[model samples]
Target: EKTETNILKGIERMRRFAERFALAAAYPIAMEIIEALQRAAPVDKIEPAGSLRRMRDTIGDLDILVTSKKAE
Candidate 1:
């Protein structure tokens, strides 16, 4: 019970931190990031995942999926 209570408290603190500091970025900004990645890396497949891929108006954090033929 004590461990569970501590876990719950930790979760609550993290939730508060996210609410205060994790503002969503605009779709255009996220797309720009994706474009930059494509230019910077020799990626076979590069795209945005998560909320950004779903075309959400705002994304909490940019989730990128990249695949490369050469491992360097």
Candidate 2:
């Protein structure tokens, strides 16, 4: 019984750690993209989707999706 409890606790701990790490990753990705856009001086501004928030797991690099429109 004790061994099973310990195993359960360990699994819980691991789950918490993963959640913590996942929450940590999002801001930097958002910031990097914003800064790059600022430096390039876009005709307007870049914006992120409201639902498109950061997630857990390893991020290799910033992934940007762009849509452009011709000037009026």
Candidate 3:
């Protein structure tokens, strides 16, 4: 039935959303990663964006922007 198919589709969408967010790390963990990056190299600018920048309790993934003359 069309209704059943719609229900299944909704369930699938929720499952994908949960899977995407379930892999999040704590805010502290994300900070540790940022610190490590700072120590690893000297960039003109490096900062956390997205949820991490908002200081969310959980971070799905790190979104960093780095500027430097060296590509390496």
- For each candidate, what is the lDDT? 0.73, 0.58, 0.71
Task: Please name the candidate that would achieve the greatest lDDT relative to the true structure.
Answer: 1
Expressed as tens digits, the lDDT of each residue in 1-72 for candidate 1 is 999999999999777556332225456676688788889988898877886777664456677888999899
Among residues 3 or more apart in sequence or in different chains, the pairs in candidate 3 whose N, CA or C atoms overlap within 3 Å are none
Q: Which runs in model 3 stand beyond 4 Å of their true positions?
A: 1-17, 20-25, 56-58
For candidate 1, the per-residue lDDT at 23 reads 24
For candidate 1, the TM-score is 0.57
Model 2 error, position 48 (Å): 1.7
The numbered model that scores best in TM-score is 1
Query: What lDDT does candidate 2 reach at residue 24?
Result: 47
| TM-score per candidate, chains pooled | 0.57, 0.36, 0.54
In terms of lDDT, which candidate is stronger, 2 or 3? 3
lDDT of 1 at 2: 100
Per-residue C-alpha lDDT of model 2 across residues 1-72, encoded as one tens digit per residue: 999999999999887666343434665667787778667654454665432344435333444454546344
Instruction: Please report the TM-score between candidate 2 and the true structure.
Output: 0.36
For model 3, the run of ten residues with the poorest summed lDDT: 19-28
